[model samples]
Target: MTAGFALSPTALGDGFRIESFTEVGSTNQVALERAGQGDPGKIWLVTGHQTGGRGRRGRPWDGRPGNLAATLLLRPKVELATAASLGFVAALGLRDALQAVMPSRSVSIVPDGGDLRGGGRFALKWPNDVLADGAKVSGILLETAQGGRDGLAVAIGIGVNVVDHPRDTPYPATDLSAMGAGCSASDLFFALSDAFVDNLRLWQDGRGMSAVRDKWLQGATGLGSQIAVDLGGRIVRGVFETIDSDCHLVVRGQDGEETRIAAGDVHFGAVASARNFKAEAR
Candidate 1:
């Protein structure tokens, strides 16, 4: 959001342009409008401060004062199902970028992450979340909008805790300051843009999501741990087994039945345990 050519992408080949602002209603809204005007390739809009932001299933993602809220828009030449997996690609890219900036932060990128506080326990959560312990540190909301007569435009909205997080939100959250970690929004954005470009290429080349899945599972904190899934109006309690190739979570219910969840709100289950583990840390 802060003006810095050092952070914006000047060399994205022919497929992208960046429109950065210090504050905005939402980057996704702005980028989607551009994609409607036959905006080709990739487009990025990063805001240093956000006034209004949102997440999946219409959840309110507060546009707090200091945080990493950026939207990357692109039109990929792939099936809807396959293109949806790009969110995973973005995660892989973000993981590396965070590592490069906070070298001393106690985060484990690819394997078991110890905690999610400050920089110590930072780790990737399945689908689109980054956590410290069981508390969320980052969240992503990927939206696919149509160009009417044209093709499809995919918008990847990322909300990282660069400074402070939403205090009134229902879910638990964290920020760099809260984790005792240090990072500037400019520094994080530059690194993330670089990573995103490369990750897009990884999917563009058909590397398959095998590697992404492997990395996700390796750093998965709740695998084999009990979790409560909130999918629409239904709530299911179970133990997370594995995230299969389809990007669905295979869960084992208390009834000894196995269920696959393609979409849902995942919580580590039971406030008692989450409290004892200091999952929220709030």
Candidate 2:
């Protein structure tokens, strides 16, 4: 059994309300349901455990009692294309929060049969994933709903491995406890919420996308390296280039031809395992 979340509205800052649960099907689902019913937004649905949690591409995301299964509901006044960029913002926020909690840890990405990248033990995988020691430590999912007269409400679901991580994953996985960071889920969540707000202010509601893009690249894993992107029916292999202004991934092939992938799954080095690369869950 997991302990109940000890979050209060005041702790979440202004324009935020937290709905805590001991267990839920999925915080994203709950937020979507509320969003469909016209939830004002700026609400966080958090559960200590999730009976039905999901990652990007509908992958099974199990939240242990001590892990975090929370979704932030937002009604940002932006178009769908721009709203998608929030994923980058959320990634930056997670990185900032993780760095604060584990400042001394060095995050490295060593893919299967791949060269290791030097840096902190925590890094951002392109699109939406946080990696610790090449294994995944956090997963992000963004959902949208129509808010009556308030524009589109996006449900930003983030899962962090606080006390436990899945051992049978295609890529290696590790948790804060396993990494020697003895922080509670509540502690991390508080930091995440604050970091997100700070990053959001920097984002300026999508107008400052350039800043978000630049910061994301600084901590991005596998940049300027050979990568394979699975585009569902087909796969593209090339050097992992920079993200375009529109946030599309730009890959430069050996032939010097550039492919601007709007959406696909990305894998560093030669593809050896099946993992959530860069695609979003429908």
Candidate 3:
């Protein structure tokens, strides 16, 4: 359980329910069905493990039971664009919660790159991916209802590799176990819940997103760094510059042009010189 929301019957709020199971197709899928049924906010689906986990752009991010394979269904008053920032807010909460249990593990933040920005100097790779040390440590996938006004009932799916990195994926991945991280899903969940609830209110007020935007830049792992975006079959390369609050990613090419990419697969480089000049980083 996070600081505010709980995973049991006692803490279930208004229409929110926590579904815990041994395995399932995906929490996001399950939550989507529940959301359509008019499920109230904070309905969480937790499995012992996710046999088939996924990230944005349909990339597979595998998850074992004990890991955090949770998704919340909510019909928020916030706009569709602002809903994307929820991932950053959740990441910050998870990072902070992890620190409380393992204070000596060198949990550092580096804005220019090479560390986690504790105070939130990290950059956001649009759609959903958090960069720490130029490598992806956490990723988020937000799907919306897609109608105007009542348009975006959302399922903010977050996947944090708590135990190990992915040897199956082309992109470099790391897990908590590899990073020597040890925290319960319950504790992390509670922390995440509290973080979301706190930020959700900010989002409701519209001020939440502005704060989210600034924190994202601070915790940003890829701002001012070069990278590429692969959408459909076309590939665009440039120095990854900024992400607007609406979650639009702006990539600046060497030709001194800025490209606004709405959706694509993002790649980051390990070497600055090699990466900062229009190279694919996956």
Candidate 4:
């Protein structure tokens, strides 16, 4: 195992600290435990290897040796609804970090636009996943619990495939190394921490969601195209519309009827076609 990540004096700025472990069960679980113990907000629990990592819907999330497994423990003064939006915030930050670390010779799959400066290979999937070259490269999971001192604490867990990605996933998966942009977990974590702080400031504690929404849409994939969202009990398929004011995904059917999905696993294009327009947490 690699040595624990070393901290730079200002890696995460004032009031923020990073605690790294060579191995752990789950960063989110450890971070939440810290929050429950009255540890002040702004802590990052990171592990290079996770034995009990989990993804959305309780699926196992693999953290390969060179991948990242980190959770940001936050005690933001916001309601549960507002705090939930942090998942998007985490995606944006991950994209920004990926862009920052992109190799100079890399050719992005997506076209550059708006505030995005690097090759457009990275795009945000609905809910909380990042794709590179049309394959999943990263995922985010947000969990919250009653915090000590602070009323509520959120653990924003993120995992990125740096050296290896699973081949048995529902949607395709890729790693940065395989894409020729190999980077150390420590290096990526530092960039992610810094990028997250900047994005958080722009979020203004979730009050600036409109800005976040606009930025997120710019890097969004499949807008104006077809998509299928699986909401566990039922599945909805339609033209990918937009994320609404409340961050709900809006999809328009062939009949022009609109459906606002609060939570679901979204798939589009070939991935949707292959899965028969359904997702089962892969």
Candidate 5:
């Protein structure tokens, strides 16, 4: 455990263990290396400061001091696709954790079709981003490798801004403290670990993905609104429809066509329009 921020075992619940560090290159990298060395699953690698963290699409994730950077190692008996759904599980868990720590009055529960622009409302962005007041507060990444006793190991990496966040980014970012949530890195981790356990039980190795999808949609951002998905080489502008059973993003294009995006960067509101214009210019 790191100095001044120790994890509470009671709050972590059962079937989960944690390895804490004051600093690490990346919690995901460390977890993967431990898995390769035959470490059993259900253990979390956490750090108050991470030096070489990463986000989706190989983007650099800056783990500023006093923020939370953690990864959970799991050895599931399911296939790769099924295991990939853990990202959704992680996102939901993060939402629950944020809600748990923040003051009840600080959180506004937004309905499925309700306005998300209201401040202090925590919502999930497609694939794996948690938004607070339309600004990103956390990100989740899942990495897999052939190891562990079950021959498959998954490292679910999660980063939450507790005291500070990077200002210059593609999307607006904020931290819990800035939102008036009085909590520390350790406080958030305890809530998150317990939330992940509950969500994992609900996930049930993807057999219960439908249930997870339904709950995730309740607090999803930009649903039923115009958005653009950046697919690396191209951008697709369409209505932000619901996600399919496989958890793939379902977008209804302006041409009356529906496109299922397996993986892409999603943009909303003015950002979506800007991305579409840039793509058209190219």
Candidate 6:
């Protein structure tokens, strides 16, 4: 176990165990490696410092000393597509966990046409980011390997900025401390583990995805607003319509055509609308 860190009783109660480390290259990497070696899963690999963590598309994820870097290894008896939906499950869990640790703050939801106010509101940015006061506070990454007893193992890696955040990023980022929340990495991890259990039960291997989708849409940012998705080779600009039953982002273009995108980087509000107008003007 990592010195001065421990999982809460609730986190370890539901057949879940943890392997804590003082420092590691990445919790996700360790989890995957263990799975390949015939580990039974239901284990969380956590570390105080992650030197080589990564985000979506292989972007380096900065993990400061007091931040949280953990990965849950699991072997679910489901198809690959169904297992992928667990990303949404993890996102919901992280959002819930953040709310559990943060102080009570009134979240104001603007009417359909107004901008979102960042008054300590915790919102989920599809498909794997948690925002606090309109800035990213956490991110989730899901990776799968094919060597477990069940023929597949999934590593759900989650990173949260507890005391510090990176400044040089394409989008805004913040930490719990910056948002007036006095949370510790261990405290957040406890809440996250419990929340993950609840949300995973709610997901029910994708059978309950509709419920998850509804809950996700409730706290989703930029819904019904102009947004842009960077699809690597091209960008799709449109109204952020809704995520489908399978959780694919449905974008409604200016021509009234709806396109469902599996993955992309999303830009919202003024940033997105301004870019859309500039593109049209060109």
Instruction: TM-score for candidate 2, please give it.
Output: 0.90
> lDDT rank, highest first?
5, 6, 4, 2, 1, 3
Cα-based RMSD of candidate 5: 3.5
TM-score of each: 0.84, 0.90, 0.76, 0.90, 0.90, 0.91
Ten residues in a row with the worst lDDT in model 6? 110-119
Q: Give the per-residue lDDT digits (tens) of candidate 2, residues 36-88.
A: 88788888888768778998777889788889888999988888889999898
Off by over 4 Å in 4: 7-11, 103-119, 271-282
Better of 1 and 4 by TM-score: 4
* Whole-model lDDT per candidate: 0.69, 0.79, 0.60, 0.80, 0.83, 0.82
Model 2 lDDT at residue 251: 91
Residue ranges of candidate 6 with Cα displaced over 4 Å: 1-3, 104-114, 117-120, 275-282
lDDT (Cα, tens digit) per residue for candidate 5, span 3-90: 4544446435566778899999999999999999998888999998999999987989999988999999999989998999999999
Model 4 agreement with the true structure over 104-208: per-residue lDDT tens digits = 333334211212223257878788888787678888999999864568999999999987888986567888888888577887887888888878888998889
The number of the candidate with the highest lDDT is: 5
Each model's RMSD to truth, in Å? 4.7, 3.6, 4.8, 3.8, 3.5, 3.5
lDDT for model 2 comes to 0.79
Better of 1 and 2 by lDDT: 2
Any idea what lDDT model 5 has? 0.83
What TM-score quantifies how close candidate 1 is to the native fold? 0.84
Q: What is the lDDT of candidate 1?
A: 0.69
lDDT of 1 by residue, 57-133 (tens): 78777767767788888887666787788777877777767766665345432222322322245566667776654
